[model samples]
Structure formats: structure tokens, C-alpha cells
Target chain A: MTDVQTQPAISTAQPEDFFQLLKPRVMSLVVFTAATGLVVAPGSINPLVAAIAVLCIAVGAGAAGALNMALEGETDALMRRTRGRPVAAGRVKKNDAMAFGVILSLFSVMLLGMNANWLAAGLLAMTIVYYAGFYTLLLKRRTPQNIVIGGAAGAFPPVIGWAAATGQAPWQAWLLFAIIFLWTPPHSWALALYSAGDYAKAGIPMMPVAKGAKSTRLQILLYTLVFVPVAIAPAFVGLGGLIYLVVSVAGGLGFLGLALRLYRSRAGDEPDKAEAVGREAALYDVRAQAKPARDLFAFSILYLMALFSALLVEALSGLGA
Target chain B: MRLTPEELRARKRRNVWIAAALVAFIVLVFGTTVLRLQQNQASERALLEAATGTTAQ
Candidate 1:
């Protein structure tokens, strides 16, 4: 009798594994910010159309995320935080992920153009291209200011939402864009301060890895100073109400305080605590010296969420300025 | 080649999800068509009314 060799079964990727390529956590933020813009825009939109527009924006963002993961799979495999991603982990093939992303991107842009306006669809298309092609393929590994320029990709959703609602992107929408654009550097660099080792290992020149922790901290402080005024600008410009004003001012102050503390501390002066301790699970649990960066990173998320939530509530309650 | 039981199960699951996605897309396109037609009709009606008012004046 001839010995029989069993061949490995073809790709066993589950639906959940494909869903993981979408980067659901990041998609949630995109959905929230986009919805807020749609709600806060001056004109009324058909409710169903608005919902579809938000869905399109979210899916478009997710498609960009999938493309990013597909292209960065090798780099992601080198980082502890991203190693579990579908493409990086080999649960989903790179070609499959790329096909999925491209299909979703096309469908989302087409549906948005039909359901809303071509302008909104065009912005969504640009966002996907900017993130996946420009940011991921060109900027990410080439420069430390990657997040600064690439931040425009994340910032476009709110403007797209505004355009979807009013068929025009006004100054207020651009202000919303500016808020996210400024917020990205500080938020990203804070996380980078504690994860510099993973970034360096992945050959990505993140701010902390390229500029040193000291300079990154100072830059964060300077960005926070500039970002807070813009965060508070919505209130003054009649886009935000009293509730938004209070939230933005208070959260801005807290953001500034955390950035100042992070600036004074030696967070990224040494190797990442998790790397030093040889424990990938200890990502959030930084050493005493790195607590400031971790704290700033955590608080920055809360501050941004609070500012947006306040705007959302004010608009929903008919209390918007 | 004979397929393994696990491969068969995975293929079946994927087929079901693909069917669901296709159905959802069909419904979205149908609804969008209906909404767009209604919007266009409303705008046309308004334009006609405005023309009639101008003629009377």
C-alpha cells in the first residue's frame, strides 16, 4: 500500500476574522465623529439618508483600515500590539484582505453618491485613498511626521458627514476637521512614547522613536496648546452651545495638564516597560517612569470623546448655538 | 481530491454570509432608488407650482 500524505485544508478564515480587518474600534470613533457632524450641520437631511451616509463613511473608513492592515501585515507582525491582527496573524491572507477592502471601498463610495451627493462620496473616496495609499504606502515608514500629515485622513470624515448633510462643506466642518487633525499628533505620540520599542522594531519612525522622548513630549505640549484653542473655537463660532463650551474648556484644561506632566516626566527615556519585562500583555501597565505618558494617552481619548459628545448632545437637544 | 469535514463546514459558513451580504446590498439599492424618486417628484411638483404662480401674476 502507498503511504498517503494529507494536504493542509485551504484558508479557514472565519467571518469574525474578516471583520477584524475592519479595525472595529477605530471604525467606532469614525462613526461617532461623522454622525456628530451630520447632526450638527445647519440643514436638515432625510433621516434614512443620513444613516446611510454615516454607514458609508464608517465602511469607507473601515475599508481604508483593511487596506492599511493588508499592506502593513509584515510590519504589523513585528509589533506586539498589532501582531494579532487578521493579516498579521495569518488568519486572513493579504490578497483576500486587499480584495475585501477594495470591494468595500467601491461599494461604499457608489452608495454614498447615490444616496447622498457626489461631493460626500468624493470626500470619502479621497479619505480611503489618502489613508491606504498615501499614508500607509508612502508616509508611515518614511518620516516621523507621518501622523501629522496622515492625520488628515482621519479628520476628513466629519467634513464628509457635513457635506453629506448640507451638500456643502463650510468653515465649521473644516474646524471639526482641524480639531481631529491637531488631536492626532498628541494622541498618537503619547501612545508612541510607551510603545517606541515596538515602533522601532517594526521600522516605523514614530515621533518618539525618531525625535527622542524629550522632544516628543515638548511637541505634544505645544500641539496641546494649539489644539485646545481650536477645540474651544466651535463654542465661540456658534457651532457649539454652552454645554459644549463647558466640556471643551474643562477637557482642554485637563488635556493641557496631562501633556505638561508627560513633558516633565521621563516616560520614553528607556526601553518600553513591556519589552524590558518581556511581557506583551503588560502594554497598558507601564513602569513608574512611563506612567505620565500612559496617563496622558488615556486622558486624551476621554477628552476628545467628551468634546464630541457635548456637541452631539447639544445638537440633539436643540440647544446648539 | 476529497475535502475534509472542517473545510466543508467552513465553505458552507462562508457561502451563507455571502448570501446575506448580497441580500442586504439589494435591499439598500432598492430603498435608495425609491427615496431618490420621491425626492425628485417633490422637487418637480414645487417647480410646477412656482411656474403656475408666476403665470397667474
Candidate 2:
């Protein structure tokens, strides 16, 4: 038998490449959610403390993304969607990335503990571990429900921000958490439906790859249905107001309608046709599936941002009142 | 593509330095802020106590 090599050859690291591993887009979302949490809480946190808390959350988010890049680099290289990532592209070495992530993690946690409450800092630390260690390293490679369960990492920012302000987590903080938890599946599955081949090529068992397209679309619709009611629940809890209620209800209805349309469209038969003219009306069911899924993904982000922004406006107005 | 052992070690050294510098800067900024917050809290407490004492007298 020919000699079998188990390990692939590694490449050199670059200084600038380390920053690229941070997944800044994801970090920005985390920061925004965390800031909203801080602003909307009942009591006032010192401006300095609030600023520091947001900074800590952002750095912690970046650190987690960096560690994820390092651990998933090999798998990332195989997928077209992730092939251009810093670690995947060989611009950063795994060890260097790991070290960078660890250092940032430590600094962020320690600073948060000192500047804000230890409760908030501890939650931030746990969020990092949940994402980098539990989700990225373990859950991602093992199951189709990875994003569903792993979505907790993203959900924690608002809760952490609430804790940073109040020194304790409350039902309102958890309400925000539940919203993100429910939103993640449909949001991620929509993208997965469009990029199933990328996940399959990478040997990742995403929902679309493990199940059929019809099943994925059904799941997206089911989750969206479940998510809409929860999205509107904050109004009952007094965390939201008239503007939030109107925006969330309208946004939720739009989301459900789009998801329903996606479910009705069948793209499993002709993948190529789906990729090409999916946005246009077509006889082949592929276009029907692809377009609505893309629409849902784009709307989900806007939906969450708008809902939270409305809540922030209500909170600020309440403060003035 | 491959890198020589010397090149790898050099890269490693640079990364460590960069990480250390970032950590130091974050700590300094946050530590000063925490100190100021503590000072403000203490002064507020003192002022409240003085006001209560004056009212009682």
C-alpha cells in the first residue's frame, strides 16, 4: 500500500492576517445588540462603564470568531462560501490565530469584570466558550441542528448587556434571548438552502444537506411561525410599545408570507436552473425555492434590527418622560 | 507551499508581541475607567451622608 499522509501541509502566518480572522461582520451585530441592551435597560449605567462594556462585548465577539476561524480553517478551505476566509486562505497560521484569540478573550473578560459587574463579564466569558469551544469545535461538525443550538452564542449579547447595566439578568433580557434563539434557524436555513452544495462539499451536515430541500423549507416556515409570536411577546412584557408592536407585527407577517412562498416552491430537482434564474418566474420549481429563501434571509436581519431599534426608541422616550 | 522553521518561529514571535501589546493597551484603558467610576461612587456616597446629617441637625 502507498504511504498515507494524515496531515495536510500548513502555511506561514501574516501579522495583518490575524485581524481578518475576527469575522468583523458578526462582531458588529453582537456590538449592536449589546448596545441596544444597555440603552434599553431601566436604570442608568455610567457612560464610561457602558462604553467599556460595549467594547468588551465587541472584543469578546471578535475573539470568539478568531478562535472559530482557527479551528474550522480546514473545513472552511473546502467550502466555496468560506474559502476566502483568512485562515482558510493560508494567510494566517492556526497556532498564531489561536494565541491571538486567547489573548483577546482574557483581556476582554478581565476588563469587563473590572469595569462592569462580574456577572456580565462571566456571561461574556461563557458566550465565548459556548461559541468557540462548544459550537465551532464540537457541534458544527457533528449534526444538522448545529446552528439552531449554537445560536445561543449570538443571543447572549443582549442578555450580557442587560446584566452589565443591572448586575442581574431579568425576564426582559431573556425575552431578547428567546427572540434571537427562535430567529436563528430560519435565518440560517434560508442561506443554507441557497448554498447547500458549498456545505456538502465541505462535508458539513447542514439541514439542507442532511434532509431534502422541501424539508428545509418546511422547517424554515415552521420556525418562522414559531418566531413571529415570540417576536411580538415583548410588547406584552412592557419591553416594547406601539411602534414596536406595529413594526414587529408587520415584519412578522411579511416574514411568514415569504417563508410560505418558499415552502410552496420546489427547487430540489434542478439545482443549476435554481442558481441561474431563481429570482425570475419559472416552470422549474428551483427558482421558486431560491428567491424566497434569499428574501427571507435579507429580511430577517432587517426585522431584528428594526424591532430592537424600536424598543430602544421607546426606552429613550420613557427616560425623557 | 511550505515555510522554513526559522520563518515560522519569527512569525510566531511577532504574533505574540502584537497580542501582548493589545492586551496591555486594553487593560490600561479599562483600569483607569474603573478607578474613576469607583471614585465617583465614593464621592456621591459621602455627599448623601453629609446631606442626611445636616437635615437631622
Candidate 3:
């Protein structure tokens, strides 16, 4: 067997090395969701405070990611997808990464409490724990349902942002939370479908690895089915306008179509076919994973940005009237 | 893949440095937030007092 073992070494750390620890990709999603919460809330938060809250959320997310990297450095080195990460590549020491993570975590929570509200700070703290402790340390290694459960960590930002604005979690905050929660499984499993072998090689039990590819595809379809209504639910609740309803429904249907295609492709059957599906799925995952979680991943970012942009527009229009 | 003693010691030292740096960074962030929060609270209080036209506690 090829040695999956990593050497212990601390090479000269590059600026990019530290940046990667923050998981910029994940930070973008967190920032957007948190900003959405601040924008769509009933009351106006000082722009300065809103900005601070967003920064804290971003920093807190980065800290959690750094800790995850520290904890999973060994496994990451074994996985093709994460082998190049600074910690996994032995460019950064695991302990250093952990220390950085812990310090940032404390700072983020304290700052959020002082600037925004204790409730926001508490939620941010829970998000760090959920991602770094519950998801990374435990769920990821333990089960195929990892992303499903771990997705909660990502979903909490909107709620935290809402609390920052309103100082309480409202049903509206939860509706936004629900949209992301349901979106997580399909969003991640698509990537997992492509990275199944990588995950399996690393001994990580992702859905495709534990269950068959067929089961993973089915779950993607199932979650996408539930995701559609949730995505558009804001319209009925008055959080969105007619424009939002139309866009959300159209986008939801488009997402469902993609999920359906993914299901029908049964593209996971042939190893050769896997690459084709991976390419197709990668198109979506890359875009969505970016900021919005929409052009498979790019469009995903746009999809969400547009959704919240609509809400902001509605708020502005209401104020004008 | 086992780490030699020297490598382990180096790792420990690096971790300590990183920890110190992170602590300093966090402290700066916290201080900035507290300052901002105090300013906001003061402004809000002033606004409320002006609107009421009284020395509201």
C-alpha cells in the first residue's frame, strides 16, 4: 500500500498558508448568510455594528476551520482532495493550527457579545463548537450522515445574524435557517459523489462510501425535493416580495431538475461514468461552494445573494413608501 | 511516519508561538468591539434624551 503517512515538519509558512486555514470558501457563505440576517431583520442595526458582527462571524468561522484542519491534518493528508492543505502538507504544525483556532474562537465570541448581543455571541460560540467539535472531530469520522448533521453549523449564521439585529431568534430567522439546512445535504453530497473514492481512501465514511452511490443520489434527490418549498417559503411569510417568489420558485425548480438529472444519470455506476458525472456535478458544486452555493456552486452564491438582495430591496422600497 | 523527538520539540515550540500571536490578535479585536459598543450605546442614549427633551436616566 502507498504510504498515506505524513511527515511531521514545519516549513516556512506562506501568507496563503494562513489564509487557507480560514477556509475562505466557507467564510464567504457564512458572511453572505449573516449579512442576509442583518439586512432582512425588522429593525435597523447601525451599519458599523452590522459590519462588526459580520467580521466576527467570519473570524469565528475561520477559527473553526483552522481547528478542523488541525484535528484532521493526518486524515487530510491521506485524502486527495485535502492533501495540499498547509497542515496536511506539513507546512504548518498541527499544534500551531490548534492554538490559532482557539484564540480566534475566544476573540470572536467575546467581540460579538460586546458589539452585537450576548445571544449572537452565544450562537457564534455554538457554531464553532458544532463545526470543530461535533462535526469535524466526531460526526465526520463516525457516520455517513456527517454532512446532514454537520450542515447545522453552516446554517446557524443567519440565525446569529438575525439575533445580532433583533436580539432574538424569530420564526423568520428560522425560515432562512431551514432553507440552508435542507440545502446542505444535496449541496455536499454532490461533491461527495465525485470525491467518493478520495473519501473512501482516507477511510472517511461519506454517504457514497457507506451506502452505495445509488443511495447517495437518492438522498440528494430527496433533500432537493424538500428544499424547493423551503426556499420559497419566505414569500408566503412576507419576508420576500412577488419577485422573490418567482425567482425562488424558478431557482428551486432548476435545482430540483439538476438533482433529478443527477439521480437519473445513475452516473455513479461506471467508474468511467463517474468522471463525466463529476464534471457535471463539479460544474454545480464549484459554483455553489464559492459564495452563493448556486452556479452549481457559483450560481449557488448568486442564488442566495439574489434572494437576500431581493429582501434588501423590499426593505428599501418599504422605507421609501 | 513516526515523528522523531527533535521534530516533536520543534512542533511544540511552533505551537506556542502561534498561540501567543493568536491571543494578541484576539485581544485587539475584543478591544475594538468594546470601544465600538460603548460609542453606540452612548449615541443611542443621547438620541433618546434629545427626543424626550428631558434628563432621562
Model 2 lDDT tens row, A130-240: 999999988987999999999999999999999999999998899999999999999999878877777777888899999878899999989998999999998877788
Assess each model's interface with DockQ, reporting 2 decimals per model.
0.63, 0.25, 0.19
What is candidate 2's CA lDDT for residue A291? 72
Whole-structure CA lDDT of model 3: 0.79
All candidates: CA RMSD (Å): 2.5, 5.4, 6.3
Highest lDDT scorer: 1
Best by DockQ: 1
The candidates, ranked best first by TM-score, are 1, 2, 3
| Tens digits of per-residue lDDT for model 1, A1-321 | 233554435767888888899999999999999999999999789999999999999999999999999999999999888999999998889999999999999999999999999999999999999999999999999999999999999999889999999999999999999999999999999989888999998999999889899999999999999999999999999999999999999999999999999899999998765777656746467778888998888898888889889999999999989
How many clashes does the backbone of model 3 have? 19
Tens digit of lDDT per residue, candidate 3, span A30-73?
89888888788887877778888899999999999999999999
Looking at model 2 chain B, report the run of 10 residues with the lowest lDDT sum.
Answer: B48-57
Where's the lowest-lDDT run of ten residues in candidate 2 chain A? A277-286
Highest-TM-score candidate: 1
Which structure is stronger by TM-score: 1 or 2?
1
Q: What value does the lDDT take at residue A24 in candidate 2?
A: 85
